[model samples]
Target: MPDKQFAPGCGLVGTVKLLDIGVPTTNLGAVRCGEARAYAFWARNAVAPAAYQILGSELAKIESMGSYSCRNTVGTSGPVRLSGHATANAIDIGGFVLKDGRRITVLNDWASADPALRQFWDVIRRSACRRFGTVLTPDYNAAHRNHLHLEDDKAGFCR
Candidate 1:
C-alpha cells in the first residue's frame, strides 16, 4: 500500500480521518467525502469508457498521488495558505489500473503518441471539471505536470 495518514486541520477540526468511499482502496489513502463522491462519479461515468476504448480493458482501480496533505498551494516549502488538501478536500490522481494488468500513468501517457491515451485523458479531464470545484491539470502549471488535482470546495474553479 502507498503511504497514508490522517492528520487533519484547516477548519476541519479533525472531523475527517479516512477517505472511505465505501469501496476497497489499494493504497488505503484518504479523501474528503465530496472528493470521494466526485471520484466515484467520474470513475464510473468516464474512466470505464476511456479504459475500454484505449486499452480494450476494464478499469480495475484508480491511482492517486494521495490526499489530506497539510500544506500550501505551492508545496511544503511555500508559505502556508491552507490548501484544500489540508482539509482532506483534495485528491491528486496519477494513473489508472486496468483489469488486463496494465497501468496507464499520467506522467508517461498524458502526452503519449497514442491517440487513444490522449483521448482518454481528455474525457476524464472534462468529466472532472464537471464534478470538482477545482480541476488542475498539467495545463494549469508545472506543479500539476504529472497528475490531475481534484478538489471540491464549491469554488467553481476548473481548469
Candidate 2:
C-alpha cells in the first residue's frame, strides 16, 4: 500500500491515497491505480479467471494507461467534473497478453472480425461491470475508443 500527495491543481485539492499493482499478481503484470486492494483482488479473482475460461490461456499481463491523474472527465459538456483518476480511483485498461503469446487489445480486438476475439472482449467487459461500479468501454464514446475505464464509484453505470 502506498499514499501519494499531489499539489493543488487540475481539480485535485488534497493528498491522494494510492496503491500500486505493479507486481505480478496471478498472470497479470503491472497496473498502477488508486484503489489497489479492490482492483488487485478483482484482477486476480474475476479478471484472470474469466480470461482463462474464455481464451483457454493464462493471462500474462494487463496493459493499462496508468491511473491517478488530476483531470476532468473527457468528452463531456456542461460543467467539468473531476475525473475518477483525480483521486486515484480508476484505471484505463487498453489490452491484455496471454501466456500463449496472444495479444488482445481493445483498440484492435473489441470489434474484431474474428468471433473469438469479439467474444473475449465482450466477456471481459461484462465481467468488469460486475465488480467495478463504473465501467466505460469503447462503446461508450469516442473518447474511450481504446480502453475500458473501470472506476471504483457508486455510479452503477456500465456501458
- Report the Cα lDDT for residue 96, model 2: 83
lDDT of 2 by residue, 126-147 (tens): 7778778899998999999998
Flag regions of model 2 displaced more than 4 Å.
Answer: 1-34
Give candidates' CA RMSD values in order: 4.5, 4.1
lDDT of 1 by residue, 18-52 (tens): 44443323542556666777777777777777788
lDDT of each: 0.74, 0.72
Clash-forming residue pairs, model 2:
none
Residue range with the least summed lDDT across 10 consecutive positions in model 2: 23-32
> Which candidate leads the pack in lDDT?
1
Model 1: ten consecutive residues of lowest lDDT:
15-24
| Superposition error at 49 for model 1 (Å) | 2.9
